[model samples]
Target: MKISAFGHAWVLRWRWMLAVLAIAALPAGLSAWQWQRGEDKAATLARIARWASEGAVGLDGLGARTDAAQIDGMVLDFEARWIAPMVWLVDNRVVDRRPGYDVVIAVEDIGAARVAGSRNAPARAALVNLGWIAA
Candidate 1:
C-alpha cells in the first residue's frame, strides 16, 4: 500500500486527540465510580431509624459516641414524618422550625404521628436533611 505523508500525519494527530480525550475522561470516570459506591453503601434516614428501633437501640442509643461504622451514608427520610404548624411553606419550600443552622438538623417530635415505628402511632423525632438552600 502506498501511504501519503498527509494521511499519516492525520492519523497521528487523530490518535493524539483520542489519547487526550481518554486522559480527560479519567477523573470523570473516577468521580462516577466513587459516587456509585457511596450510593450502594447509603442508607435512608428512615431505614436507619427503623433499624435502630428494631435493634432496641432507641434514638438515644445513637449518640456522638456511637460508631461511625454504623451509619456512613445514611440519608434522611423526608416523607416519614410531616408535622403541623407549617412554620414557612412557599411553593414546595417547607421549612420546619430550626434545630440548628446547617444542611442537617435533628428535630424532636412535637406531637406528630410516627411512621414505620410500631403498630400503634409511636411518637418519634428524626434527623432531617433540609438540603441546601440558596442564600
Candidate 2:
C-alpha cells in the first residue's frame, strides 16, 4: 500500500487527539464525581448537625415512620427497660484519655403502646449504646 505523508500525519494526529482527550476526560470525570461525593457528604453532615441541634424527642413523637434515613441521627427519649442477660461489651474504646469498653444492651420501650407501627402491640427491643465502662 502506498501511503501519503498527509494521510499518515492525519492518522497520527487523530490517535494523539484521542489519547489526549481520554487523558483529559478521565481526570475531569473523576474530579466531577469526587466533587459530587463531597457535596453529598457535606449535605449529610449538615443534616446530622441539624438533627443534633433540634435536641432529643420522645419516641412516640416519631409517628409511624420506619425509614432508616428518617430515623438516623435522631435523638429520642422514651421509657425503656433494659432486657436482662443480653449485654455486649465493645472493647478497645477510648474515652477522655482512658481506655474502656462501650456497654451495649437491648432495651424495650414500655411507654409506647405501638412501636414501629407493628400490628401486634409487643414491646420491641432496640440496642442502646451506653457509656464507656472502665476496662
Candidate 3:
C-alpha cells in the first residue's frame, strides 16, 4: 500500500497532538483524583491537627521549654504530624502562614481555617492540654 505524503504528515502531527494532550491531561487527572479523595484527606488532616494540638499542650504543661528553639521544634513536630499526610490535598503546601504567624489549615470545599491569634486560642489550648499539638 502506498501512503500519500500529506497522509503521512497528518498522521505524525496527529500523534504529536495526542501526546501533548495526554501530557497536559495528566495533572488534571491527578487533581480530580485528589478532589474525589478530599473528604478522607480533610478528615486525616483534622485528626492530625487535633492530635498535635493536644500533644503540644501536654508538653507545655510538663514544662517543655517555650523558648524560640522549643517553639520552632514544636511547629516542626506539628507539621510532621499533620501536614505530611495531606501534602497532596492542596496544590501548594498543606499549611499557609500569615504575616503575623497564623497557621492556615486548608480544606477542600470550605476553603481555609486560620489557627492563630485569639480566635483559635481556646481550642488550641484545649488541644495542647490534651497533648495533641506536641511540645
Top TM-score model: 2
Q: Which stretches of candidate 3 lie over 4 Å from their true place?
A: 1-12, 43-135
Candidate 1: RMSD to truth: 11.1
The reply for model 2, stretches above 4 Å from the true place, is: 1-12, 84-105, 113-121, 129-135
lDDT accuracy of residue 75 in candidate 3 = 33
Question: What is the lDDT ranking, best to worst?
Answer: 2, 1, 3
TM-score of candidate 1 to 2 decimals: 0.29
Better of 2 and 3 by TM-score: 2
lDDT of 3 by residue, 29-88 (tens): 999999979976777677667657766433224355556433433432232123222322
| Cα distance off (Å), candidate 2, residue 1 | 19
Whole-model lDDT per candidate? 0.54, 0.80, 0.42
TM-scores for all candidates: the values are 0.29, 0.56, 0.24
Regions of candidate 1 where Cα sits further than 4 Å from its true position: 1-12, 44-46, 57-135
Model 2 lDDT tens row, 21-127: 99999999999999999998898789889878888887666788688777776788888888998899999999888899989899988767554466467875677
Q: How much is the lDDT of residue 16 in candidate 1?
A: 72
lDDT of 2 at 38: 100
